[model samples]
Target: MFKLLLLCLALLPAFAGAQEDSDWIEYRDAYRQMIWFEKYGKPKQFLQNHFRIRPRDKSVPTDGLRLTLNGKATHVALPLDALGRAVFPFSKAAYDDNAELAVNRKAGQLKSGAWVSIVTRPDGVYAAADLRTACDQLLAYLRYSGEAAGKSCAGVQFSYPKNDVSQVQFHAAGGAVTMLAPKEGPAFSGDAVTTFRVFVYRFAALPETGQVVTSSTPLAIAALLE
Candidate 1:
């Protein structure tokens, strides 16, 4: 368990090496999907792109999973957050060399995808309006890209690390507070892993009266679809 935590939060340059070609999570494919967000000329200030990797089999455990880049000249460990996602490192050097992603503590055949989430604040404080704007931004991008046809931003879900015990709260004006209860839910709406403690703060459930604050940092914050 401790080892898994290390891998989840491992910093850049933590581990680097080559792996078998059979484990090819190709860099080109990741780059293509990731580059769109980088080149997108739309408003997505509140959203960030992450490359997510999960086991193809639902039962496979992903704890302590680590991703690495292996190339003739480029070798490095990609820092993965609690969600088994890494900020898609847009490296020209790795691209030119055609590097591929390798995994440590292999869980089996893996599938990869791109995810959009709200940019996290180190202070763990979120304004009520800011959360709405972030959700709105994601919905706009999804609609603009022809992904969300009639989707509406219902609320936001805050995903925390495994075994999280902190409370998420909505603080209204004059010290009134609403508890954003946490439950064992998937990291995202359709994510493969579903063991994290996710706090859902639906705008409908609570008025946008106050700011939201977390006792612990969230792994990701995603829009709640309506």
Candidate 2:
């Protein structure tokens, strides 16, 4: 009887740990994948990198989803933006601990990945010349990374949340605003979410005059390659 009781006491700590660190992926894995962007020597001043929590199940509610890094030496809460992304944190301490990226949601319902997007302006305005340059930059990186083979930078796509009726228009130097038509499309290329208000501003469709693109609140402005 005494031996059985001793065995149960030894197992108590292990059981408690399993429950505490539930629903987690190794933080070292995330660090290794995301560290590439930081080390890339390419010109990407107009771009930003984020860590995304992708819900495989479309029915999962992410309204109040929370993520954290769990480790003996590191504990940080990662806040998600409207697009389910957060500016990835670079923590050597977290890396050393081989921590866990755990979420409040149930396990096996979601996956995590990296996202690269065009940098947005606070005033929701981007210069025509700048947009072209940004698209070209993304194309170069994609090609270097062996993606979008034989494709060229065609335009830029603005995406907003379903609740936001946003607008994207080009403002000519002389003062004419041309509104880009809004259509229904997914925020990302694939994996659910096919109802965001999307607006595509193709360079070929409009004259590349000295202009600026204005927006209201775009969750993301993706580089359109074709």
Candidate 3:
């Protein structure tokens, strides 16, 4: 019986490590099908948003992005100030106040805070300085995959003027994306069609070692462009 007790004590470290590995949970929005990660039941990444579709009903708020978090509908407005600057409503304080951390503990990706980027183009005839237009050039890249030279490389790239923030380019690729826009023309099109492509770059980095991690299926995203 003493030997049995000793064996249990020896395995305690491994059991605790496994539990820590499984601490995170994924939450996905059903309406747009975007995924987010949480650690200890709080959002690790800021909320993701997009505006490629304008509902026929004018009653709906199409000027900003709306999401359903924890059974409650939350909105984040995309506004451009009079000085022609971008305005995001989700400040750290605002997020803390409204986030539904305990609501959907069972949902999202397997990890916390995914690195991603998005590309959008205009579809309708609104003012050029409108919220949607202001956000057209918003680009974010949080992860780095070190497979740019490989045949199967998948990543995002863009070019912008030194001072101009309004004019920019956006693109997606199955391999290393070199250009700012699609080269082979758009695969899909419509009279009221605006394209918003999201790229989920697969990358991993060791904080202690500073080594690059590459994924076989690195680039992925479910674009709710319809």
lDDT of each: 0.72, 0.70, 0.21
Which candidate, 1 or 3, has the higher lDDT? 1
Which stretches in model 1 have alpha-carbon errors above 4 Å?
1-22, 104-108
Model 3 lDDT, residue 152, Cα: 25
Worst 10 residues of 2 by lDDT: 1-10
Q: Mind sharing the TM-score for model 2?
A: 0.84
Please give the distance, in angstroms, between residue 226's alpha carbon in candidate 1 and its true position after superposition: 1.8
Error of 2 at 182 (Å): 1.1
Clashing pairs in 3: 26-107, 26-108, 27-107, 27-108
Question: How do the candidates rank by lDDT, highest first?
Answer: 1, 2, 3
Candidate 1 on 73-153: residue-level lDDT in tens? Answer: 888888887677887778888899988887764424566656677888889899989999988888777665557666677
Give the higher-TM-score candidate: 1 or 2: 2
Best model per TM-score: 2
> Mind giving the per-residue lDDT tens digits that candidate 2 earns over 18-69?
3432457677766765676677788989877787776676787777887788
Residue clash pairs of candidate 2: none
Order of the predicted models by TM-score, top scorer first: 2, 1, 3
Off by over 4 Å in 3: 1-89, 95-98, 101-115, 123-226
Q: Candidate 3, overall lDDT?
A: 0.21
